[model samples]
Target chain A: MQWLHAVPWDLLLIQTINGIVTGMILALVASGLTLIFGIMDVVNFAHGEFLMLGAYIAVLTIVATHNFWLALIIASLGTGLIGALVYVTTLRPLLGRDPLTTILATFGVSLVLQNYALWQFGPVARKIPEPFSGSITLFHLDYSLYRLMIAGLSAAIIGGFWLFLKFGTWGIWIRATTQDRIMAQAMGIPVPWVLAGVFAIGSAMAGASGVLFGPLVGVDHAMGFDWILRAFIVVVVGGMGSLGGSVLAAIFISLLEAYSSLWVSPAQAGIISFVVLILTLLFRPTGLFVATPK
Target chain B: MTLKDLDKGQVTRRRVLAASGIGLGAAVLSPMPLRYALAQSKPYRIGSEQPLTGVAALGGKTALVGLQMAVDRINKAGGILGRAVELIVADDESKPDSGRRKVEKLVTEDNIDAHVGGYLSNICLACVPVFTENQVVNMISVCLDTTLTTSKCNKYTFRPYDFAPSQAKAFAPHLVNKMGKRWFIAYADYSWGQSTRDAYANEIKGNGGSVVGTLGIPLGTADMTPFLSKISGDFDGLFLIFFGPDSINFVNQGTDLGLRKKYKWAGDGAVAVASQLPALGDKIEGFVGVDRYVPVFDPPLDTPYLHAFYDEAVERLKKAGLENAAPDRYVQSNFEAMNALKLGIEKSKFQGRADSEKLIAALEGLEMKESADFPTGDKLLRKEDHQAFVRETIFEMREGKYHLLDTIPWQKSEVPPACTFA
Candidate 1:
């Protein structure tokens, strides 16, 4: 009882808020990665680089225009274009290859993108000016309004994406492509074009996530690397290609991170997630949301 | 008959004369400058390798800023040895092998007279052998792993910053006397962190402070809950020896767990970075740490030159909109190192590669009074270990700001005598 009360309620709440904000962003990035992996059977290791490119675009746009919304649009579109180009140039040629080849190729692409970014930006952390600056007091706790807004926006985007994936025409095509690419192609669906479109949309989502995260986390070349590990863990724990699982796992991991920091320490929080991952693999390799192998 | 015919090659003499005439004509009438002109126009090159795109990018960028600033200042002051310094910078990406390769490229291709900049201890350790092999002077700006100075110390490597043992020795007595006698240490499980923890533990015990517990977590850990929980029961002071983003995470979680209120927290220069203070907020209040520089130092004499440097740094940061940003120890250390290097160069009258060794030799006994730009006191760079015996400032965070509590002046301290070259 004493230990329970000893926990700093205010600090815990703040950290939880931070976690949720981070989790929402994670869900956005992971959703795109999971979608690419589901539809194309490609891990798309460069997905994080797409996010980084998005953030850099947003930073460049914001520096020029000083408008946040403009920056977001440009960042998303620019990332989508880059994603499509990546598919056409680097990925398209390697299609129908071994899974290991795809993974290794994507890893190489990621390295190329990282080095290109480093050469262009010269490794300085560029900050995107916050749109809604400062904080608001809620429940007698001061929280960054921008952070809360980001969380709300991320949730809305995720919900809209879920609805689209479930009911929309493109969503249906994506599912078909994921389930039976050969049959989908036999039915006269332009499979290659659909795959390219999916890559673009997925990479665009990652870009948008980067734009949203830029102001909160600051933009750096390595920001993509920082989140990629977590996104992989989130996707694994949520179940591969399971959008619902991704959402659930993201929240679970965030809450675990929040509560663990309250009870233990932040350094251990990462370990806890890995421990969960190991345990999940040991027991339910398909993750909490079990999915049939395609 | 065939050998004579070959030797008497009638067309060869005429062809050779014609080729020589064409070569002379091309050399005299070419659109581009001659080889001698190009050689005369080339600048003396200095090389630097840093983790420019990885986790240590910020530190690398800061070191670059210092290096460039020093180069600019030196150039403005009539240049080094009457020749302008040209810096050839490369990104090591925080990899040990990459760092060695980058140094090799710099030494072999760039023909750099001296090398500068190393943020990570691992990278520094890896590159030291390359520098030693090439007989190039390496002015290392950061990297606190004790092994860099002791076991790995080479004639070519000179560290401008105080090493781990000196930092530990500076803080331990203070922790025992001012804070408490029971100490708990939590550090990252890396060369830098391990060496720091070992040094601190030994010094704390030596200073009559008992180490109640010690915990080492892997690098890149985002959560420190279990480790913190295990040691939370009863320690008077907690010595945190983590760096970079890990330190930020630890302090935030430590605060959330109410660990700061229960025990006094002390950390190394990693925690002393002013940029990290805002992330810590009120949580870091009353937390004490050891650092090389603090903005709140009170000196008897106000040097205009120091004030100008401070004002310039503040202006540069403000223009970058990081004005309110906390001053990192690396940034301050780089500034001091630049100044120290200039002093060393001037004292030794360094003219070329041969003179760098003499400059390093002069650096061993050089001392400077802390002006506004640097802190007050004398720093003696030890000849044997190539480690600087510099003063460490003790500071406490107050209301999201750092306040200097005391200054530990440089004392001639012994290097870890047990360390030996294999």
Candidate 2:
């Protein structure tokens, strides 16, 4: 009771908002990565590069147009097109090869893309202006309205993607491919095209998250690096290829990290996520969010 | 027939001609400058390891430019000790392991006489041992971790620029008097940041101010807002210790969370490097910080040398695709560090790695004058700690330009040496 009384309630309230907002952004990024792995069985080491590409596209788009929405749309479309081209040119030929081949190929691709971004953009970080500049009082701090908008926008995007994966015809094809690629191909589902389309969608989602996140941090070549690691954690913890699980795990992990900051230092708090990852792997190999088999 | 062809003592005309031709070809093929090869044959091989394509690539690229500029200048002035200085560079890829490996190669394989580079502190710390083991002089360019000259100081390594404690000593009075009394410190949560934070905190306390709280955000933490959201309550100002993209990220996110409006913002000069200002836009307005060098042509720094250095740097940076970017501290410090090595070599008459002791002794109390080589200012590299205390300039950002506020002399900013060389 004494320890509870000493706890800063205001900090708790503030961290809740922080956790939720941060979780939504993480979920958006993880959704694309998990979606790709789920459908294609290709663990894209280049997923982060796609995210970086989206932010770079958004930077150019915003600079020319000064419209955040236009930038978001253009960046998503641009990254999606690039993703499709990547699939056809690189990933397609190595589809039936050993899993290690695809992994190495994507790793090679990541290096090329990262170096290319460094060469093209140089090392200086770029800026993307937020559309809204308003804030609301939240405890002792006045939080930026743009942060809340990012959370809301991410949710909306994820929600719309969920709907597409549920009822839409193309969504059925993707689900069918995820379940049985051979049967889907036999059923005249255009398996190769579906795979290409799924990659584009996954890449588009990554781009959207990148643009949304650009305003919070400098748009640099390595910006995607920091997020993609955590996204991998979220994917593994939520059950890889489980979009629903990834979303749930993202929020849970973020909240845990947020709450841990109260009792421990940030470096210690940061370690809790990795600890959780290790524990889950040891105890529940199927992932904490996945349904265990009887 | 074999014994006749092997003839060790035979001095036939054909054999002599063949031997002479082989010797001439070998001399011509040698990497040493042909003119210098005539007088003093061996070149002084200098190696630099930098994060050429990783997280710290921006500063690393700029640092390389400065080092090259110095080497070019040294060579143009008829080389050091009448021997041409050859520079060998290795890319560390911004990882400690890679940095150490590169340094090992630079030492054993390249057989470099000296080294002059480091951008990231951890990478620098990792490679310090390689330099020590090989008995090579290391002129650290831009790594500002306090322990480099303190607990972790080595005989082989020397930081020829300002570090955290001195910067803190120079700026804490201004921060306490002009800014607010109670402060919250946020830092990059790494080797450099943690050391810098402690230095500032101690200085602030010494100056009759209070450090209300401190937060250390892990390097490359995607969103600092979560960590920043924890920063609230009674704090008069927010002091930041970060560099590169981390600086831009923290400022952007912290401002987004209204921390900017709530508290007076001040930090390490790295937060507002000239290249990063365009990205920061108007957000950096009114932020006060301290640095040894800023790319402004003000009094004391308005010399013709600085102008020449600035013009060439600007043109080079433009060619490197950082168009219109002013040379940052990385560029300034690296240029000076290399030049300092040249001066040391010239004074010691150092030839190669065998003369490391002589070079170290000469550089111990070396005085650097304000020239193209040391365009920032005059300073002395302390014999005790191998750290130079340069004049610290406190400046404020106004319309994305650094406006000089005050300057603290090297004598005033110098802290007591705390290093014991092994």
Candidate 3:
């Protein structure tokens, strides 16, 4: 009873909000990575490098234009083009080959991209100035305005992506290609073009994630390494091909991380997330949302 | 003899004249003397391994710049023992295994005469055995774990940087006497952070202050809101035990949360280090912490020796287009370490392994006098631990620059007596 009385309700409320915001931001990045894996059957080991490149592009854009929205557009489109270039140059040849070859090739691409960034930008950390200042008060607790805006914008973008997939011509073509590539080709759909478009869209989302989180996270060459690990955990715990599943998993895991910090050390709290992942793998290999194969 | 006769038959009168001309050319250009040949041969290589790719890459690059400057200065003055010095650098990527491999390559493949490491205690700790096996002198800079100078202390390893316990002990007086008694600690959850937090905790307890709460943050953590939000107890100050970008993220978020406005802040002065402080600008004002060196000390109070070195360093930095290169602890430590190496080599008249042993003996307990090269007054190297004893400065951030508040004289007893080396 005394311990219950010692609880800081305001702090808990703030952390809960933080967890949700972090989850949404993470979902934006993970959704792209999962989408790429689902449609192409090719795991992009360089997905984290794309995020890093996006952050760097955002840094340049913000410094030059001083407009966050312009930075986002340029960063996303720039990174999207780079992603398509990577697929054409590296991934296309190995598409029908052994998956191991493609995986190693992507890993090599990751190293090249990381070292290239290191060479070009050096290792210093640069922060994107927050467009807005101060915090918004909700439930008598003040939350950072930039963080709240990121959450709101991330939710909107993710919602917009779902609607696009449901109605847009290119989005429908991408889905058809993903469901059955040979059949989609038989239906006179250009499978290769649709696949390329999906990859571009996925890469764009990852780029936008980087730009949105840049002000909060501090942009650096290796900033994407840790985020990519969390993104992987999110996709794994969610059904790999399921869009709704990844978002839900990200939120669930982030909430656990936030609430656990109140009781245990942050490192230990991180371990708890991995534990949940391992337990999910053991009990249901296909994840929470994926139906067990007969 | 038959073959020589056959070759002689092929040498005609024109060939003889041509051979004579070639001999003159060779004498004039190529084979001047054995001395010239030795001069153009291998230089005295000093190897350095640092995190050139990962999160701590900024610190690594800064330390390398300081080392390169020191080498250039030494080489300009006819080099060490009249032989030019060469620096062989390898990227460790902030990984201990990579550090070990790089050290092994430096000592074995490059055949480095001496080496230095910057940042990441785990990486430094990993390279310990590599140094021992190769019998190379490793001047460690910016890795603050006390065990390096205590239980893990070795003849091959010498630390020019201040350890965690010494810095904590030096700053304890101000934290307890001036600031309020209650404190909350937020620390990164690695070797350096854990050790630093422990050192501070002991100091606070010994000084009759109590801690209200403590939180551990993982490495590469971008968000600090979860930890900051939980600081609900009645604490007078917040002690941050983080380094590099992690430190930057914490301070930025802590300010946004208005925690800095509410509570007095104290931690490692490295939280506002050279490359990092400029980014934060005025936000770090009013914060105080302990530092190994602060280049902002002015004339009269600061030694003439220090001022002269500062002027030279600033000019060099400007010429290199590093206009923002301020003399933080990392740069100073590596610069000091390079000078100390030169001093040791000159004193002992280095020859080879036997002379390296003699150099180690000469360096142990060496009392360095204040000079243009060593501008930070007198420094002592304790024979038992090979830990450099330099005065610690407590600096407060004022007007976006560090102002030296007080200087703590070196106390031998401040560092715990060493245990036997493994």
Candidate 4:
């Protein structure tokens, strides 16, 4: 009871806000990963490298253009092209082969991308230009303006994506292909082009999130590995191929991290994602929000 | 045998007979022994291994530059013991198992006489037992875990720079006496961080100061807001033990959140590294830290030897076309360790393990005075634990540069007493 009274309420409030912002950015990255996996049935081990490339593009573009918003768009488009190139040159040929082969190929591609980034940018970490700096007081609580802006931008993009998936023509085609590729092909849909489009869209989302996170954590060749791991965990705990589940699981994981660090040490909090992942596998293999196929 | 015959490239009977007679005489004299003797007189090799890839690649490359600079100088001075010095380098990629395997190969197959390595603590710890088993003289350059010199110290290993305990001890008195008595600590959650936290806590207690709070931050933590929000109070200063990229993130975020205005800051030398100063800009101004070396220092402490070495190192880096190369603490520590190794080998006339015992004996309790080699002034190699005691500085960052505030002369520690070497 005494320890309960000793809790810092103000600190708790700030961490809760931080947790939401973290989850929002995570969902932005995880959405692309889950979408690609759902449609193509190919797990991208190099998805994190796409994020790293996006960060580098953002930083370089900002340095050249001196406009954060323009840099973000250019970086997204640039990474999308690279993602499409990867699919056409490497992944397209591996279609109809064993899934394990594609997995190993992507893993190899991850190593190559990491080393290329190291060679191109050198080992020093860098930061993207801040769209906005400092903090804002909301409801008498101080929150970082950069974080809040990122959260808002992420929500808008995610919401827009959800709307497209629900009503857009290309979105309907992608959904139909994801459900039944053979039937979609028989229905006169270009399955290969749809798969390529899905991969490009997913990579573009990852790139945008990476650029957004650049100001918060800085950019390094190794940053993608950590982000991709967390994104994978989010997608797994949310149930693969389930968009709504991804958002919930991402927020849940972020909250677990925030509160766990408040109560336990930060070191222990780092393992919470893996711990939740193991527990979910042991008990409910389909995840909390995942729907069962009847 | 005539000059005209040789020029014409003609093999006359007389020329052939004369050449055969000379060759037979030379063979009979048995020149094979002389050829073998010359082959055996090759330069002594020092195998240098560090993670040249992965996250720790920058530090490893910087340390290698320092070692290479020392090697070039020693070779130019007509070598040591009439034998030129050679440095062979390998990358461990920041993996402990990789470090062990590389060191084993260097010692067994490459026939390297001695070794100097390992930028990260875990990698250094992994190579310790291998060095012990092989009886190879190992010079530690960068890793700062105290256990390497105390509980884990071996007859074959020597640490030439300040460890975690000594660094914390040197900084504690300044924080308690001048700054204030109440302190907060934010340390990385690992062996290096744990040891630093323990050392500072003990020192603070010993000096009548009290720790208000302590937070164990995970390494590579991208977000520091949650951790920083928890720290609130009247603590005079915050002690940071984070390193590399994490240090940059913490300082940038912590300052933005008004923690910089609230408290004085102190930490390891990573806080004011040259590479990070531009990114951090004026955010880390007024920060103080304890370090092995700094390129800029107070006028009084600037010895002529220090200036000459710094100038030469900078020139060498420029000549090699390395833009980011600067003589930071990591470079200086490795440079100093290489100099110590050179002195030990020359004094003992080292050949191999059979002669390494003598080299180790020669280095024990060796005091080096201020000279071209000993740029940091007088240093003592403590006979007890084989750790060098050198002068350390407490400097404050002002105007985007580190200005030395105070100096602790001949800083020594036997904090857990001497290693048993059991």
Candidate 5:
């Protein structure tokens, strides 16, 4: 009872909001990765590059339009288009080939994009002013309202995407394609186009997350790197190629890291994600949220 | 070239491709130098390793610019001892393994006379033994890990700029007296950060101040919200030791969490480099820092030679796509490091790797005066540690520009030699 009283309940409560806010952003980023992996067996190393390009596009859009919302939309559309182009030019030719080639291709694309950003943007981190400059005090914290907006907006976007998958015509096409590619193709669903569309949708989600999270940190060529790593962990932990499971895992990992920071340093708490990643691989390779395969 | 698109009808793709290939081959086999007028004498090959890609690429890019600037100047002024200073640059890729491999190549394959660049401290530390083993005079550029000149000091390496210990000694008094008594140090959680934290912590305590708590975030961590949330309790100032993107991330996230309002922001001068000012914007305002060189023209720093150096650097940085970027300490150190090597070569009348001992002897206890070459100011490359001490600039960022506060002379900032090179 005395030991329990020693806990800083106020800090714990604050970490809850921090975790959820961070979790939502992670979910948004991971959702795209999981979506791509779900439909296509391609492990996109360049997913982070798309996110960086999204932030860069958002920077350009905001400069021209001065509207954060417009920047988000333009960034998403821009990355989605780029995603389709990449698939058509690069990924499409190597579809039935070994998956390692696609991974390597995306990695090569990542290097090109990262260097391209540096060459074009010139190593300086760009600023994206938050749409709102307000904060709300909670217990012992004065958290940014923009951060809260990020979480809410991320949830809304993810929810909307989920709904689209549930009801939209293309959504059923993607779902059917994911279930059985050959069968869906036999049923007249253009398999190549569906794969391209899925990649575009996933890339669009990643781009949106970038613009949403851009204001919190300086938008640079490598901004997506940290989040993408955690997103991969979440993708693995939530079960690879499973969108719903990935969302849950993103929140789980973010909350786990945040709450653990209450007792351990953030650096040590970060290891919690990797530890869980290893454990999940060892104990439940199908992921914590995934049903054990028969 | 794309500019050679004279006519679409005449310059077809095949013809254009053929012309481009020929031009590329001509440029590669016999590259032209527009700056220097030197004899046909064999050049002094200087090896440089910087992160041309990966996380620290920005700083590494600027560092090469400085190294090139110095080499150009040296060559323009009758080259280094009548031979052109040919700089052989290697992209470290910001990894220790790659850095070690590149340095090994620069030494064994390239057969460089001496080495002139190393941007990241961890890479520098990793590559130290290679230089010592190969008996090359390694002039460190921007790596600020204190151990380079202190605990892990090496015979082959010479740091011709201020280290963390000197900076901490110079800045700690001002921080304790002017800023606040209690501080919380948040560092990049690597060799450089860890050493710099200890240096500042020791200096702060010595100045009758205290470090309340410290946070160590891993390098390249873009989102520090999770770590930064734990840094709330009570602290007068947040002492940061991060550079490049990591610093940008820390300041932005820390400010977003109301940590900026709660605590007085002050840290290394790197937190507000001229290139990063555009990214940091107004968030970095009022942040005070100390550095060996800032792109400022204040009192003692506003020398004619520095202006010359500054003008050239500004022009060159613009050419490198860093528009409006003033030469940071990385540029300054690399420029001076090459210059220091030149003086050593001249002093010893050294020719190549065979004259390594003579070069080392000449460089030991080297005294650099304020000039176009050493624009930062007078420095003493102390014999014991081979670490140069220069005037530390204490400044505040106001309206996205640096305003000088007080200058700490090298003598005032000097810590006793703590190295015995093996």
Candidate 6:
């Protein structure tokens, strides 16, 4: 009771809200990663680079058209196209090879993308103009409206994805491929096309997340490095292949990070996620929402 | 037959005599003049090594710009020591080992008289040994780690900017008196961060303030919520010791969590970029940070040279389509350093690398005041430490921009007695 009273309630509430916003962004990134890994059994090390490309595309689109919504759409689609191209050109050759080989190939691709970005954009940070400006006041707390919008939009996108996966024809094929790739291929399903489609969809999701994140995080060549580790943690803790698990884990980790900083130091908050990750592996090795292998 | 033979022989003899006389005349005229001309026009080479493709590329690129600008200016003003100064540039890619190898190449292969541009402290540390071994003067523009001057100090390397310890000493008293007495320090867990924290803590404690807590975050930390929650309300101030993207994340997350509103925020290097304020918008307002450069200098002494530099930087940025990019003080510092190096070269009348060692000795003892560009005062290059004593400008971000709040001058008497050079 004393500890509860000792807590700064207003600050705690503000941090909690901030945590949820950060969690939503994390979930959006992890959802795509988990789906890709679950369906294709490929760890796209250049996933973050795809996000960077998306943000750059968004910036270019906005500059060319002056329509933010159009930029978001184009950026996501553009990243999807790039992802498809990567699947055909790089991932196709490495599909039946060692997992380490695939990992190394993706790492090489990541380096190439990062260097390309550096050469293209130079070293300066590019700011993404906020689509909506202003703050919403709630119980003496001033929260940015744009951040709240991001959280809401991320939630909606995740919800829509859930519905699509549960009901759509291609989504069924994706689920089948995740469950039994050989069986799905025997049943006249094009396995390669399914993998490529999953990769594209997953990459498009990442791209959308990037567009949404640009205003909050800003766009720089090194921006991908900042979020990729956290995304990995989220996917791992949420159970490697479970989208719902990722969302739950992201929120849980975000909340823990938020509350801990008030009692600890803000710098150590990132460690808490890893600690949770380790604890999850030790206790519930399958994660909070472990999917049964079909 | 006898008449014909006599005519042919006489003709051949006259031709040989004329040819011998002409050859002797040509030899007498060519040798001395060619020797004199060769001696008069030897090219002087200046080498630059920097991280052109990695994390420190922003600073390195700007420093390169300044180096190029200075070289162009010097050449346009009739070259150094009446010899054309040629620049040999190398990209170290932010690796210390790579930087060392590049410096070795610059010294052994390029045969440069002087070297400039070290954007990272680690790279600077790697480069100092090479410069010392080669006995070439190295003018470092961006490395701030104090150990670069202290334990690793050498005769050839000179730091224009104040080191971490000096920065901490200058900032601590002001923060303690003006902001609060209880402080929380947070930074990346690395040699650079550790040294900064140690120096800052000592200064803070010396100024009668207590360090409430300290946390060393790992590099590439994205989430700060957990760490923010741990800070006690008893703490009156937060000192962030981070740079680049980390600073931006910390400040934004700190604000979102209402930490900035709860306590006074202060730090070294984290909020030093002027462009960051506009990017941060309302988040960084009221946040006080210390830097070595401020756009505004005190009145009654504004020079056209300073204006010209600023105007040129703005124009170049605009031409590069960075019109909205914030003018960085670090870039200005690099520009100033390049100018100072040229000034040292002119003063020493250094002919080449042979004269560079003596020129470096002179540079270590040199002091400049009443320069057209530096109106506040000139930085004195202490021979003992090879460190420049320059003023630290303190600024606060207001309305998405930097406003000059104060200046801390670095005089000989102002330095602590414990500070010494071996």
DockQ for every model comes to 0.14, 0.79, 0.43, 0.40, 0.59, 0.28
Considering every candidate listed, which one attains the maximal DockQ?
2
In model 3 chain B, which range of ten residues has the least summed lDDT? B32-41
Q: What is each model's TM-score for chain A?
A: 0.93, 0.98, 0.94, 0.94, 0.98, 0.96
C-alpha lDDT score of every prediction, in listed order: 0.75, 0.90, 0.80, 0.81, 0.90, 0.76
Q: What lDDT score goes with residue B153 in model 2?
A: 98
Which lDDT value does model 6 have at B398?
A: 73
Local accuracy of candidate 2 as per-residue lDDT tens digits, B1-422: 23666676576778778888997898788676653456476778999998898788888888888888888888899888787889999999989999999999999999998999988999999989889988999999999999999999999999999999999999999999999899999999889999999999999999999999999988877788768877878879999998888888888888887888989999999999888887787888889999988888767667898899999899888888898799989888989999999999999978789889999999999999977789888999999999999989999998788898988999999999999998
Candidate numbers, best DockQ first, in rank order: 2, 5, 3, 4, 6, 1
As for model 5, its CA RMSD to the true structure in angstroms is: 8.4
Name model 2 segments beyond 4 Å from true: A1-4, B1-14, B17-39
Worst 10 residues of 1 chain B by lDDT: B412-421
Backbone Cα, N, C clashes tallied per candidate: 14, 0, 0, 0, 0, 16
- Worst lDDT run of 10 residues, candidate 5 chain A, spans A134-143
DockQ of 6: 0.28
To one decimal, what is the Cα RMSD in angstroms of model 2 from the true structure? 3.9
What is candidate 1's lDDT per residue for B25-62, written digit by digit as tens? 87778764463343334555778787766777656765
Better of 4 and 6 by lDDT: 4
TM-score between candidate 1 and the true structure: 0.72
Task: State the weakest 10-residue window (summed lDDT) of model 2 chain B.
Answer: B30-39
Better of 4 and 5 by lDDT: 5
Off by over 4 Å in 5: B1-40
> Is model 5 an incorrect, acceptable, medium or high docking prediction?
medium
* Tens digits of lDDT, candidate 2, A94-157: 9978999999998998888888999999999899988879899988788899999999999999
Question: Of 2 and 4, which scores higher on lDDT?
Answer: 2
Error of 6 at A199 (Å): 2.0
Tell me each candidate's TM-score.
0.72, 0.95, 0.90, 0.90, 0.94, 0.80
